[model samples]
Target: MRKTIWKSMILSTLAVGSFAFPVPASAAVQVNPVPGLRQDFIKGADVSMLPEMEKNGAVFYDVDGTKMDELQIMKNHGVNWIRVRIWNDPKYGVLGGGGYTDEQRALELAKRAKAIGLKVLVDLHYSDGWADPGQQYTPHAWKNDSPQKLEQDVYDFTRKIVQDFRQQGTLPDMMQIGNEVKNGMLWPVGKLPAKDGGKAFFRLMASGLKAVRDLDPDHKIKLMIHLPDGGDNDVYRKFFDMLVKDNGVNDFDVIGFSYYPFWHGSLQDLQKNLDDVSARYGKEVVVAETAYGFTTDNYDQEKNHYGPAEARRSGFTATVQGQASGLRGVMSDLAAVPDGRGLGLFYWEPDWYAVPGAGWKAGSGNNWENLSMFDQNGKALDSWDVFRDVSDETAPVVPVTVTEMDEPEAEGSTGIPVKLPQSVLVTFSDEHQEMLPIVWKDSAPVYDKDGDYSVSGSVEKIDAPISCDVTIKPKANLLQNGDFESLSLDGWTVTGDKWTAQPTSGKGDAKGEGSLHYWGGTPYQFTMSQEVMGLTPGKYTVQVSAQGKEDSSKFCLFLIGDNGEKKTAEISTTGWNQWRTVKIADVEIKNGKAVVGVDMKGAPDKWGSVDNFKLYRQEDSKAAK
Candidate 1:
């Protein structure tokens, strides 16, 4: 319980830190030059070597121009290693797929890294498409093989790949036999160590491990057993112990875990799990895949895969500040480990920001960019600054992995649930953009797509620098999935709210004004720097506004408290469309900043645009009482 209080305090501090400080507009963060260090763990990033449009087609994406220059950037961020995956006979969805094979893109990137003193870790997937525990289709060449034949093939393929890389001076410092092999590779013969006491999987893994050892038997190369979901130590224990029980597979090097907050548990849980695993097995541990989000709402919903709540519970606030804080938490936990067993980490696809055609969606771009290390325009994020030295003595300038726990919790309960608040009508409206003016609610509202309110399924960005709480309600629609969640530009937050540049087509979307802010409900002004502006102490009615209206533009009004719950309101807007105004004649303001923004909930198409808003003192003054 005491530990819980501290974690909560850290979370709260992170939430209010933004509103408390005066942030610079369009500010570029200063990255401290990471001092040269002899790090035991490999600090790397999984930058996909996108199969070139052609052999050398400009590397056309995020090259030096966009900070996509891997070699230099890795060095800058204290990333000393690069992990590249290899696929067999894959067209990668191009001209019958005349793209990079294992010897192509991976080799090229590996060569580049080696040439620049960067270490490489090679991942062998033996399959054409993505191969995890769920889907591990044997490569075409090995599809027709018998169990023994497949084992031999794995040994040969792995040996040949390692030898080839070694000959090219790009030999891997560490090699991952398979990618997320919850179930082992090669299928019926090599699936995960079965719950039914099977030896097929262990034998297959041994085949790969031995092949790696044959080429260079001096333990010069570290071997890592990769698994998805870091929070589940039970999975690791089950998989590893089964492997250990087998006579064929035992001499592995490190335990690699994937730590994705939305999918994995909190870092507290992860650390405890890691501490236990490494101590028991006597192996090093590295979080091979980790990333935190910088934005709560997606700007271009078409591309990217990060739907809301990507990084909320694990103490990551889902804001630029939160991402920074989250990294700090992970690193600090790593530092506290004994024997420095916590090697380091790799930010999974950290460079996956918004490129011209780079997004998560199939038809659109990938949605993972919102959680990328850099912003869409290739700007480095503030999150990088989170990596710091132990005590400002051992090269404080350089990016250090696993410094001491900054605001650590007690032993257990890192994953303990906080009693987050439920949905409350913070603010409501009938027209344009309607949003619940929430401010740092202990927990974001749970408004699902039940087809009632025009809401947004996106999670609340409840961290600092943007501590305002908000939820864009979705509208109900019979024809489609009711994308009625219109965004409001009121109450300290602004989003397209499912409102795009395109024209409205159905019920959910409509032109704005009525939903978000009340046009003349006094005067609710805004300036991002101030959280609670010192208002002239007097009775005042809060006024609001909305944008993107064709004719009689209307507005809504509401006062909101911290955490995004509705506070107070007076009247509503009925008529006055053509750039006109309306009022909700009542209310008062004591002091501090009054958060304001318009909402375009249920608004569709070119729906929910907003601007020109303020807060005014009520005329009732002394007489209203």
Candidate 2:
């Protein structure tokens, strides 16, 4: 899911205050030539928030530190097309900021893009807010319209928008009928699984198609039917069959798909689906949206959508080179499509890097900064070279030698076999590294005694064996960062008003310099939670060393069992720095995970500090057998 904030271009010069901008560290990726690649292959990016970012004091810099417009940098790095999304009356709501992507903003962006000799693709969301597979809410103004009225509204609205763009000489090169309509658009009436066997959905889609075709009978602008999950073959085959074979609505020229490997299936699945669908339907295919995180670090208060978990799933490391590798992988897959059916791909929101005032909505922070093509400093990432390099696609790079290997790490109780990472990072001769699959006779380490151990394995490409060193010394503390030594809430999710990390003086068995601290001048409630995943079925104990103001403030250490059972231990404090141990024992771990947290509630001047939050397994547990 994409989270973005936009502002009016007129207000781009407004001051939004200062923010920390880190300098670019990695060198630009080296471009390689891919033989037989189409000369007109699309290298696109959706930088709809360019103006909004600029309004919030964002400045774009080229690789060489030359401050410039983001679009110019994109063009310089081989970006040939840009995608801009337009929402119907999104002045207020989730995108509310008086600067949402209305028709005016989209047109302005389109005109600027065209002026730069870059093609523009218009994405019509058909909703005031986000319209994706999970959401397709009817616009507020069209909420009360009948099915017949709604269809006509869609037709008229679409025609008028196209007419405006055409009159301004900024006609889109391509247009998406509706954003990610796999589940249908303009919900309820046109929602999927209709009683009329998808007739409503098809009719709604056909109306939009007819509107665009009516304006441009010569088909100067190609229209596309967009869908999510490009890797799912069954979804594509079934969807297109219903739309074309059964419903006879095939006026669209391109089949657009959104493929995010972390959310969708693997790269192979994407290639298979794209190859099959293009041949089966005989239409051009384009990856409408795709992005990968260059880092797992959170640049703002909002939690990053693509974290370490997503990185591991994407089979790539969270690094600049990994980002380039991912883009190359997608580009290579698209290029391999039989019969040149693959049109190209558009990187989603590549310019929406972190800016203090620019967030998904008001008061929120950026959750997608890690996935942006630019770094926190607004400097272009080396991955931008993928657009330039893919043109010269030569033979694939191979791992000649293992330059580096990331050691695997895991924590579990003694005598239990803990599952280690299946893939390990291996930097190869190509200068880029990937989390390639590894094999070993003893993949899962069974430690009879608690300590640290090294496990060796063979990586897929490297001739030499790679080894991993892990500490069995959790002392059975399943809760990571229990001592808060990281000085950050690395493993915990803090919700409610501003719980912070404060330094501790080794108070009452707290080993780290940091402790989870919370202070509120007014009444408030907060939860600092850590979800420990992949636990063996057994009984466990949750414990924490805590201190607080000796008052009526309610602070409790709690645990939600895997099956949703809850247990809590009320924490009592005598005075500041007078720490006491709070424990909740006999918590059953029926599922493979447990949620442990500290929930606080109180009035003005209430304060608390917690450290050494740990979960311990019972000796006579069922999993121990």
Top candidate on lDDT is 2
Which residue runs does candidate 1 get wrong by more than 4 Å? 1-38, 50-68, 92-101, 193-196, 246-248, 297-303, 356-364, 385-625
Per-residue lDDT tens digits for candidate 1, residues 297-367, read 55554533343323323344456655655554555556556677877777777665555444332335445
RMSD from true fold, candidate 1? 16.6
Candidate 2: segments with Cα more than 4 A from true spot: 1-27, 95-99, 393-401, 408-457, 466-625
Return the lDDT, model 2, position 292: 82
Task: Report the lDDT tens digits of candidate 2 across residue range 1-625.
Answer: 1111122212112111110011133334543455456899999999777777888899999888899989999999999999998889885446554237788989999999999999999998888867887678889889999988889989988999999999999998999999988778888898886789899889889999999999899999999999987888988998899999999999989999999877676787898999999999999999999998898887778766676546655655677777877777777787888989888999999999889877777677887999998888999887798788767545233222334565555566765556555665554323343456788668666776767777777764544465666667444677656776533455578776432223233333244556766665446788889887667677788899887778887888899987787788898878677888888888778667889998888666776678888887875344445
Best by TM-score: 2
If scored against the real structure, what TM-score would every candidate get? 0.57, 0.70
Error of 2 at 401 (Å): 4.3
Please, what is the whole-model Cα lDDT of each candidate in the order they appear? 0.50, 0.76
